[model samples]
Target: MFALEIENLSFTYPDLTPALEDVSLQIKRKKKTAILGANGSGKTTLIYHLNGIIPAQQGRVKVLGQQVDKKNMQEVRKAVGLLFDNPDNQLFSTTVFNDIAFGPRNLKLDPDTMTRRVQEALERVGIRELAERPPYCLSLGQKKRAAIAGLLAMKPRVLAFDEPFSGLDPEVADQFREILDELVEEGATLVFSTHDVNLAYGWADEVVIMKAGRVLTAGTYDLLRDGQVLKEAALPLPLLAQLFRNSHEQPRTVEEAAALVEPGSGRLKAVDSSR
Candidate 1:
């Protein structure tokens, strides 16, 4: 069975319009999945369903073979760690260390174990040096990492990140990507949402595109590239894919695309240089 599953799940706010409509999908265990779409496309809504924060009124949502419902919320919470788009929404303690330790505390882990988990989590995000800083005192990127550390301390099997790289400089974004890759490598299932197609292509093993509160497409990187789902979703293709569109050969990387597009001897020279 898939690690996480959503079947015809739909959600609507009391007064606002529908946030998600009959959306269904599955995430394999330990696979890194990226949810891509334009803003207000219900990407965040879908992740919330996985964690039981937004209960499905129309269809079923499951995690690890168990359906998400009030009765199983405790189990579901332990299984899924949700990182909100805004770090402020996730971080809630006088100091960074307390914030990171909160999850383990709720789980009733002993003080010794909680301390170890907090330290490991902070180190994992490379924020160990900021352990005592106030949440409001840290930089935006630091807060993001600390927020993630808080979730990591819980040691959840699945992590749902909403717009993780929303507002970071290039260097910090790269660091965030590395942290995510490490978590996936360590067998954590990652479901992250972002509109940045460039990062989505490079980072995700599979892409699920959402539009108008429903899934428009779901596939591997090559499948997404072959189909014009991006255009249909009102999203841009990855830059390299955009450059190589309709070309006889498809290039997976920008350097490869440069080699493919450059003329004759120059193309050969570019390939050699990349090599």
Candidate 2:
């Protein structure tokens, strides 16, 4: 089952340049899909159509078997939860718990079940201690977690994120990665956008590159290893890809590279660690 199936989808804002043109693709279910593109590449515009945030101007969008239209807009939204680039846009309740509860509350689940889900979501995202804190007083990382908790409470089939790690510090990003790793391992279907080729290489099971409102390419994560594709999208090859350009043994992550560079493997001597 595909997490998303989009066909001939096109959208253009009034008096603005086209944001998406003839886009068509299917994201695999229960896997990490990363859309890579520079600014103005329409990555954000595309995911918005996955939910009902941006109405379809041309073709079709289906989320987890439910066709997206005015009739099934709510169902499509319920199937796919979007995590915005900015936490401020999603968090409105005074306390973090209430902010997270907002989505589940709308579902009208029995009060006991709603409370259980809300608390479980908070614990899953590691924000239970901050549940009573005012969202405005929390740190940015905390706010992001709170926002994600809100989506988790809804239990959507697919979770879409515009730019999950855009503004986070290195330490915070590391922490965020841990949470995402757990989710992905538990078979949570995710579609997230990022301009960071390294992040896409390390995190995504599938990669989709966009350029000027068009899909430049889409395939397995190894597709990012192709310098030509990245070059066309004005992106560089991932750091690991660059490091192993001439090598037959390609390592996608630091852990893999380190394992391949064991005592006297000779591979370690050729690499310039300074990079």
- Residue-wise lDDT of candidate 1 within 25-76, one digit each (tens)? 9988888889998999999889888899988899999999999999999999
Q: Which window of 10 residues has the lowest lDDT sum in candidate 2?
A: 266-275
TM-score per model over all chains: 0.92, 0.94
Worst 10 residues of 1 by lDDT: 266-275
Q: All candidates' lDDT scores?
A: 0.87, 0.89
Best by lDDT: 2
- Residue pairs with colliding backbones in model 1 are none
